[model samples]
Target: MAKSPFRWIGRLTKPVLIACVIGFFSAFGLADRIAGFSANLGEKDRMVRWSAVLSGATRDAIPVTLIDIDPSTMAALGHPQSAPREVLAGLLSLAAAKHASGIFLDMDTSRPGSPAGDAALAAVLAAYPPDAPPLALARRLGAADQAGNTINALAEQASVLDAAVRGKPNVIWAASVSRIDEDRVVRRWQLSHTTCAPGPGATLPSPQLFAAAVASAHPRPLSDLNAFADSRTQTACAPGTAAASPPAWPRNPDQRAAIAFLIPDGPDLAAPQFITRDGRRVPLFRRMPARALMSASGAVVSPQAVADDLLRDRFVIIGASHAESLDGHLTPIGFLPGALIVANAVATAPAVLSGQPVGPLGATLIALALLGALVAITSRLRPLAAALAVAVAVLAALMALGRIFAPSTASDIVLAALGMVAFLSTIEGIHAIGKDWRARGWRALLKPEKPPAAQPTETIT
Candidate 1:
């Protein structure tokens, strides 16, 4: 029984072909269509989020906000000529008044400094106090002293972190865990991680180090604290993958397990709330008024938001989420909104408290879905149809998720819309460039005559 030649061509269409290829790559985590993830929440309808939190849109219900240094701040900071340190210090002070959960210094302090400027900022940080503190402050409990709060003392001791408050014990630093992608984009970033100390004990990334520094500020004696995650896990990851390093353990037993204990948990993890800095609100992407951010003196606030949150017992993560600034990462659904990073962090904090990780598999699945969907659209469907399908799928998926979970749909919607556009463009590009070379050749057979090439000299000679 011989098969018919035409049977070979039974099922070939743009959609199916592309979808198959896309699905295969997605399953393997190698979709290469997207440019990369972004951290910009300045775009309309986006929120920021970061990791150390659990799952994706499913867990997006959590609330963390972007204390943006927007145009308003820019104006207050004095454009290009004036000093920015004063402005930053003022913002910190203002947020403190608003009772912000905690302030994470998302900005890089390594840069932007002069002796005078650094001293000014350090003085401000030293003034604030922490909810809890080291023995130094603890010893000073009954004894009166003309110094800042416990937060200020600890922040001051965090000289490696930059500068500090002189007598305060509650200040802390915050940094990001940036990850690179195939496309050379900083798509996914981690708020914390475990790493080798490196030769000569090179320091860990800022986020983890800063977190460690903050966790150490507490009065809990190291002897009573149970630290973990520093030990190497015996388990091996999958083939070609690097082994998972253990996370840093805090000296405080409760915090040795997680940072949630660093401060008391107050608001519902998912409540949509933002800290109103200095009783003034900034446009989501813009900044608030100068007067609102400033103290009667040239200084910003009487006390930083750090003092307020810690003194009041709150959770804070002072980190930046500026996408145009390339200060963001790729998340499960795609790249996360900067605002969403804060949300993800707060959401994941519970898991850390409970010792329940959302599992790498969940994030893996999201990346796979995005990659697969893109390849499918780009390879198979018509440009217009693929685009429409992608948009619809993204919207439907986000809406569906949002209906049950809080804002869990943002990533899905964003990725889907992007993939749809990509796939459509790729398909159109392929078609527009021309295809079916075999068919074109076949048409040549119907030509009247061939333009003959010169023949070799006759061998008969």
Candidate 2:
């Protein structure tokens, strides 16, 4: 073959050899576009964030609030046997009387009336009216039967309950999204708050939303409390003789309620300690102990603080804090105390309630700039050394950013981390590919392939 003079040049230059790898990622839409890079990087960063956030066994700042019971408690309580309905009622009543700013009920009534096991739970829930603002079912029980009868029955109960709690206090429901990225970590909390019915009536709403509606429903300005009346409609979520099932309650000016917040709760959590009595301490996630007291008993927070905040017209979300009940969250520093999250809920309610938004792009650009400098400096170093430097830098950046982002409750951390990861991975992948390509070319040119005729010549000899 003609002397492949350019072959040696390709081997030494390295750029030509790495072009295939570069082109491969680019063609796959991974390394080529900013959006793609941002997304992939964002996802990986989310994983790392979760790891770092949940690394220690410490509790999360967000409380692992338990509003419902699980199988273990059920077994302990001697089920098939139920916790006295009165106990359930008393606890809720206590919370409301204590000026507990808000309450969220996390439970499912999906199979109500379907079987003996489900019917008892349904009755206890139906006893509370939706208008009372003391409770909100996290969700209607999903369809358990082929005919969807179970779902229909639960929907009716929810509707009936919704009517009773129309505008009392902030009694919100909870919802969650099931989707996740390449990693199982839930990056987004898709308001798991929605419902459909196959029965005469169906209804559903988040406890937070209900509670906000109640708070937001207080029509008067902060100063003119005496003149304030609920401007919110009193329309019940129950069926109104519509040919098809009527829509759920708080439906006005659109289906949206007055309250909505984008804060997320981790699904990667342990079950909560659903408190039925006043004195029992609720357990937190990971079987951690958290005291759960009837809000009325004033066992949890200082009365002075509670009174002051109540007077200031702040909302309070009082739920049991137990590890077994998982009333805690995994925060960056460690497990944050649940009490702090409750305080944040009230302290920043105005911003969250008002729907303040922070831009991800701004965060991304800033992070990228910082990372770019770091990458540039590290790029010249050996791979291991560079990796270590980048890792340290990332940790420092995360701690600083955690402080900045916490107050605003923004998604900036994920976006920023993603930006950093993307740039670094791209550069590293490219360099490795280039080196590999260069090595291959060097081997090809330095030790040319034996002439094909040599094989035939050996046979002839």
Candidate 3:
């Protein structure tokens, strides 16, 4: 009897269908979490260039600036963890004089230092004119969530500077924290202090917000700070909508804002030019050594020049950027200083407002479509051939998409394709097993052993 044409397909159907269902569910469930991790996998160098290229690498400088308390400054000052409070005060004083839009110190002033230094810094902080840019000092916040906490209680949760500096009205305290992923990479920026329970007359602002507060400072009040605090939008802004308004603050204190990193245009980061891994040119904000803020004689550098080059109307972030600071992190663009991380977060505000980061919906749909095509193709082609073809096509597609979309979304698509591959491969293995079993049975049934045995016995008799 001839075998039914549908027999082979029937054998493959159950396993294939079962695998597809599992694949779909798993892809939807874990793709966003696990697959999105270790983005470059071990290809940090290449991925860095790729990430920069996709971020629309540019040659123009951004408005932000980095005043790093880097190695050079450290060598001059003879301290590791702290820069002279007097020096910091001098920097701030100069920034104020230059008409800076915002000045943020990514330093921990939680403890009191030299009294004179502290007093000088405090004096500078208090002396800023109403028209001058705001100065925000970074403070570390405790991990305990304050979701239902009281006013006084929430205040206690903040690990702020000593009473002297923390008491100033001109200085805003922005929490400096990064939502680190399992891979130890910072992919999200927490915008609210929701975790620190809500209380009356108490608000928690992120360091990013403090920096922005300075950038957005004008003679006129924008609105009650609290009103805008919890209303940040995570979705991309609509077309032609002005990003002019201060960035939306998330209502959920734990909400994480997506970070769209700027690409590097050069290898020697300290140099003026930035370069992507692919040799493409990109622009970055002006970065002056923290040493530049002061002269070799420990005097403040050209206040006017500093103002024109870095401070005037530009958002300034001061932090430790050199390697010894140990603040470097693994980014899509390889290891970078924490200063750049803050800069990236600040820069992301405009990008998000401009709707540059594509959402996951479109990428998810594309992933699903590709998965379905893989399933259909595997059903018809030789199993091995199908696997190879699908893998090649999917990887290529993902690479192309990674160039256009964010890494997070690209990961989702790749993850979905991987799930489909697992499903299809399993079904093929089962079909092959059944095919071999049937082949063996047919060979046995068609064997001529019995006739041969009978003839041998008769001849012997």
lDDT of each: 0.39, 0.38, 0.58
Per-residue C-alpha lDDT of model 1 across residues 90-125, encoded as one tens digit per residue: 656555555543445454454446667766666667
Candidate 3, residues 1-461: lDDT per residue as tens digits? 45598879987999999899778868789645555554544353344444333443221223577777777888877755667778877777777777766777877665677777778776776565665666677765543344344434323243324454554556666666677888987767766453323432334566565554345322223243444553332122232444445434321122465455663423465344443312334334667677877777776776755546456656777777655667777765556787778887664343222222444576567767887777776777885898688757655765566555544345456666666667867887666666766657655334234552233334564
* Stretches of candidate 3 exceeding 4 Å from the true structure: 1-52, 55-62, 143-171, 195-203, 209-225, 230-254, 257-283, 305-307, 322-335, 353-366, 370-461
TM-score of 3: 0.61
Q: How many times do residue backbones clash in model 2?
A: 53
Error of 1 at 86 (Å): 2.8
Best by lDDT: 3
Pick by TM-score: which candidate is best? 3
Task: Give the higher-TM-score candidate: 1 or 3.
Answer: 3
TM-score of each: 0.40, 0.44, 0.61
Q: Indicate whether candidate 2 or candidate 3 has the larger lDDT.
A: 3
Task: Give residue 306's error in model 1 in angstroms.
Answer: 14
